[model samples]
Each structure stands twice: as structure tokens, then as C-alpha cells.
Target: MIWDAVIQPFADFGFMRRALLGCVAISLGATPVGVFLMLRRMSLTGDAMAHAILPGAAVGYLVAGLSLGAMTIGGMIAGMAVALLSGFVTRATALREDASLAAFYLISLALGVLIVSTRGSNVDLMHVLFGTVLALDDAALILLCSLASLSVVTLALLFRPLVLECADPQLLRSVSGLSAVTHFVFLALVVISLVGSFQALGTLMAVGIMILPAAAARFWATGIGGLLIAAVAVAILASLSGLLLSYHYSLPSGPAIILVAGLAYGVSLVFGPAGGLVARALPRRHLEA
Candidate 1:
């Protein structure tokens, strides 16, 4: 009975199988991007960029009526624009990066809502906001798989430059003139990952898998490699748990997955080895003569 309850959903339903695959693909690709975002202290930037893609997706819906290719292209364009524009603003103005990001995402979100209001029904809007993970078809799967492959490869090639740039921008620039190229390319990869994930997690909640797992991993891992491994593991587990919870409890799959990741994050916060609440709360001893 326990086995049937827990495992039968995927065994019985093709949609469930597809959804699981989609989540796993997303975790494989997006969680690493999340790790980079966390290391750059740009977690909030991921959230902002996620929102910035909305208007473009809404425009795609208006143009193509839920066409996967159209929305993906549009979202990618919008996200890249916001990222570049925000970077330009940070360099050009006294306003900090966070402030610029906040300003841009708000405008983007409002524009998206207005566009959806004028062009689409409430149901369409909800689908964009929450996603249709269980309804993923062949085209969606192909897009996600391709995106994951590309993101992983790109990250591997750029790893050294990215690390150098993050660690010391001046030093990296002095060593090579690839600093600007590296920054933009990294931003592009982030946008692609978010676009790929939008179908499973929606634009609003897409950052959950990326940020949450990476954040939890920070609590447990002292080194960058360990952090990436821990984050990917957490994301995969959360995806599985969320899918099962959604199946049995009749919950929304995207939110369910995010909630599971959130639960993991909470547990890590309390008991993680690095700097958890328990670690902080434990009494310290002094050396005696």
C-alpha cells in the first residue's frame, strides 16, 4: 500500500513521468546557475531577472498563443535586456545594482500584468504565472533538455574566468580583457536557465529551485565544489518530493516543489554544519592554562 501510494503515480501516468524528467532536467541546469548567483551575492538578481522576463513572455503569448518557441525566445530576450540594462545602470549611475534591479523588475512586472490583462484571459495568465508542468509535451521537453545541455557546457568552459572575475574583478581584468565578455556571457547563461525553467516553475517562482537549494548548500558546504554538489542534490530531491506531494495532495506542482526546497532550506538553517542556528547556539569553550 505504501509503495503503491508513493510510486504508482509516475508508473501509471505518462504525464507524471514527463513532469519528473522536466524537474530533473531543470535541477541539473538551473541549480548550478543558482550556485553562481549565490557566490556572486546575486541571488536577488536572479529573482529580479525572472520577473523581467514576464512582459516578453506575455508578448509572445499575444503573438503566438502559447507557442513554446515564441515564449522562450521572448523571455530570453527580455531577461537579457534587463540584465544588460541593469549592468549599464550600475556602471553609469550612482544608484547601486540592487536598486537598479529593483526598479527594473517592478516596471517589468507591471508591464507584464498590463499586457496580459489586455490580451489574455485569467486562465492564460495563471498558466504563465504558475506554469503547466504536468502538461509538458515533446517540444517542451526537447527545449528544456537542450537548454540544460547548453548551460552545463557553457558553465564548464567559463568556470575559470567566472571564478576569477567574481573573486577579484580588477585582478581578472588585469590578467585578461575577458572580464566584460565573461560577465555578459554569464548573464546570458542565467537568462537561458531561467527561460528553460519557466515552463516548470513559472517566471515568479522559477528562482526557488535555483536560490533555495544553493542557499541551503551554503549552510552545509565550505568549498565551492561541495556547495555545487550539495545544491544539485537538494534540488533533485526537492523536485521528486514536490512531484509526489503534488500527486497525492492535489497541490500545485511548481509550488509544491518550491515548498519542499523551502523545507530543506529551513532544516539546513537549523542544523547545517557550516553556520546553522544550532551551531551558533552551541556554547563555546575557552582554553585553560
Candidate 2:
């Protein structure tokens, strides 16, 4: 029966179907964002923004009582605010990047929890920490898909400038003709990743959707395009497996999904085609020949 749960996640169950769709849609948006995050040294931005969405989402629920659309919009606003604050903190303080990131995630989460205390809703706080995939629905599916599509389209158009600016922010002034539009566009992509993934992974761990896969893919590929392809494939496959495993075993879906992604990252750490431990070790022996 446990095995059947894995194989049958796509069976006639509505919950299972929703989980699968969420996995697919999330990866579609997150993969490119993951690439950019990896390049920009802002991977934690996803994590920070995810937590920041919480207060807004909870407040929206207080106002409207579980209308997902309102809740999500609120979450998006909060996410945008977090992104801006992260940048502001980094700039205005002598604090290091990691310090600023920690401030954003921890403080925002505390604020969210405080607001939730006032709402009188029994919405499981644990469920927010680790999402409940079985509760997914058509409205969420549409929203996630639209966000993903917008992310992909915008990224494709701004790919070159974004990559260039990420490599050298100083080029903003030097490139005479190049607008710093790439920075704005990349922020927009991060927003979509946060918004699109919130329902699946919630505010706590959703950054895994935008970080783990890329981290894993780094071992297997060198070029940006190749790394992105590997990242997308790993994220989708892990998400698919994790959702099914969680549904069958009654585990928390979001963390379970992230665990799967982490496992993939571990695998790449040890066995990836390019930079795995084995790959580095193998070259030494061959050189001795």
C-alpha cells in the first residue's frame, strides 16, 4: 500500500492531481530564478521573502477569512517588501549579507506569528511551516501557472543583461547604452518565485523550490544553460516523488518535498558529472597514468 501511494499519486484522486500540478508549475518558475540567485549570491533572498509573505497572508485571511486569492495577493505584497528591505539592510548597515538575510527571515516570521495569534483561526501553524499539499485547488493552480509563465517570459527577454549585471553590477555605469533594467527584472522574477511557490511550500521552507535544485545542479554542469536544465529536471522529479511519499506516509509535504530536493543536492555533491567528489578524485588517478 505504501508503494502504491508513490506510483498512484496521479490516480483519480483530486488531491494527488493538485500536488503533481503544483510541482510542475513551481519548477517552471523557480528554475530560472534559481540560476539567477546562484549567480547573484542572493539565494537566501528566496528564503527571506518566503517568510516575509506570512504576515500579509495571515492578515488577508483575518480580513477575508481564507479567500486564497486575497491571501496570495497580500503575500505577494509582503514578499516585495521583504525583497526591498533585504536590499536596504544590506546597503544601509555595516552588517554582512548573511546577517541581513537572517534579520529579514527571522523578524518577518516573528511578525507573522504575532499576527496569527490575533486572528483566532486554527489554521495549523505547522502546516504553514510545512505545507499541506493535499489541500491544493484549481485557483492556486491557475495562479501558480500564470506566475510561472510571466517569470519565464520576462527572464528570457532580459537574460543577457541580467547575467551581465549579475556578473558585474559596476557595469551599470560603464556600459553607456545598457540600462539597469536587468536588476529590476530579476527582482520581478524573484517575486514570482516567492508567490508561485508559497502555496506549495508555504512561507517557511519554500526557498528550497528556488535554491536546492540549482545548488544540486552546480555539480553537474558548467554553463548557465546546462545548469538551469539540470536544476529544472532535478527539482521537478524530486517534487513529484516527495509529494507522493508525503501523501502516503502522512508526512508534512513541504519539508518532505524539500528533503527530496536536498537529497538530490547531496547526490550531486558526491556523484555529479562535473564537480562531484568522485569526478575530482577520478582525474587524479588518470593523471598518474
Candidate 3:
């Protein structure tokens, strides 16, 4: 009965409700990961981890025949495997993170594509690159929620140590008992979050939202807590707005949300109050002496 006209899009139906909830969950869990990813200069690698989830999903679908539990387990394994490989290569050789990331994803993607083609489930390709949000069922919702909750806990407990390592790896290294090992483990968790969320936002756009909002937040804030708040707030608003726009216009939700986030990034670039273009260009703020 024109519920959207009266209420928010989030209340239009179970589908919209779950979609919004999923996005909100991701916003809370992934935004902080974005902050630390940026701090590590590994900002652009989230997409690879997302795409790296494809082969796992494919294997999951084939072996368990569309069971969400199996697919999640499979995808988690695949993501961890990729993260492990990247960590191993970086630790062993002179090759940098970018090179290792490229190698891992390219190979994993090729394998996934081949497997999916052989299984005659080409539609899964779309799910791999961009997930079907309207199709999510109760089980998937539960899984997403659980993962989000667990991630929040991990982030809370490890917040300080992770930051210390990100900001000053060498200094942290000198202290005995604390290894770069802990930092590597944390990055694996980040990859797991990306994989778990691949169904809602896809690999490409997931990284965009994950990294962009946090980046925009960093233009002004001095405190990590404040910056996290700014990023999470912006992410939630952008996600909900983007979802409503897409539903009304019959557009793809993933790209729509990412676009809104990209727009925020553009605005921040031009006018975000500190180091942004407009912030730098116009007259400085005048204060009474």
C-alpha cells in the first residue's frame, strides 16, 4: 500500500529490511578495517580478496549444492588461503604485497572461472562479482549478522595493538614477544570480512566502500575514535541512501551504493574542511584574537 511513500525503503518488505540490515552490519564491521588497511598502505587489495572468494563459492556450490553453510565455509577457506599465500610470499621473498596480491587473485580467479564454467552455473559468475541482495534468505542473514558481531568483538579487543603495528611496525618489532605475526593474522581476519561480505557488495565495490569512506574521514579528524565514527556514519548513510535509490530506479544495488560512496569521496576531496581542495583553496577561517 505505497509503504515506501509513507515509510522508509528499509520497511518496504523483508527483502529491503534484510538488505538494509546487511549493509548496516557491513558498515559497522568493515569501516574500521578500511581505516587500518589505509594505514598499512594495503588499501587497494580488498578487491582481490573479494574476487578471490569466487572459486571458493563455486566449489562450495558444487560440493554442497547451494548450502549457505558449506559455501561460507568454503569461501572462508579460500579467502584465508589467499591471505596465507600473500603473507607467505611477502615474508619469503623481496616481492612486495602488490605483486603477491596480483599473482594470488589472478590465479585464483582463473581457477574459479574454469570451475564454474565446467559446473554449468554461469549465473554464479554474477554472484561472484556482484551478489544478488534481493535473493538472500534467512540463513544468509543470520550468517552475516554473526560474522559482523564476531568482527566487532575482534576489532574491539585488538584495536590498540593493531594500530600500534600499523603506525610503527619497526618500533613494534623491536619489542620481544610481539611479532609481525600478529599483524599478519589480523590482515587475515580483514580478508575474511571481505569474503563474508562478497555476497552483498561484490568484490569491486566492496573495496570502494571499505576504503573510500575511511579515507574521506581521515581528511579532518585527529583522533582514531572520532575518525572511526565519521567513517561509519558516512558509510551507513551512503549505504541506506544508495539502497533506496536503487530500489526505486530498478538499478543494481551494489554499484549504486558504491557510487554514492564515491560521490562522498568526491565531495570530501573538494570540500571536506581539511586538506580537501575547497578547504585549501578558499579563505582561511578567521578567529578572534
TM-scores, all candidates, are 0.95, 0.88, 0.92
| Distance from true location, Cα of 109 in model 2, Å | 2.9
Q: How many residue pairs in model 2 have overlapping backbones? A: 0
Please list the residue runs of candidate 2 whose C-alpha ends up more than 4 Å from where it truly belongs after superposition. Answer: 1-7, 86-106, 176-180, 284-289
Mark the 10 consecutive residues where model 3 has the least summed lDDT.
3-12
> What are the clashing pairs of model 2?
none
| Comparing 1 and 2 on TM-score, the stronger one | 1
For model 2, state the Cα shift of residue 87 in Å. Answer: 3.3
lDDT assessment of candidate 2: 0.78
**Candidate 2: residue 17 Cα off by (Å):** 1.5
Top-scoring candidate (lDDT): 1
lDDT of 2 by residue, 96-143 (tens): 667776777687778888888866455546655556567888888888
**lDDT against the true structure, each candidate:** 0.92, 0.78, 0.78
TM match of model 1 to true structure: 0.95
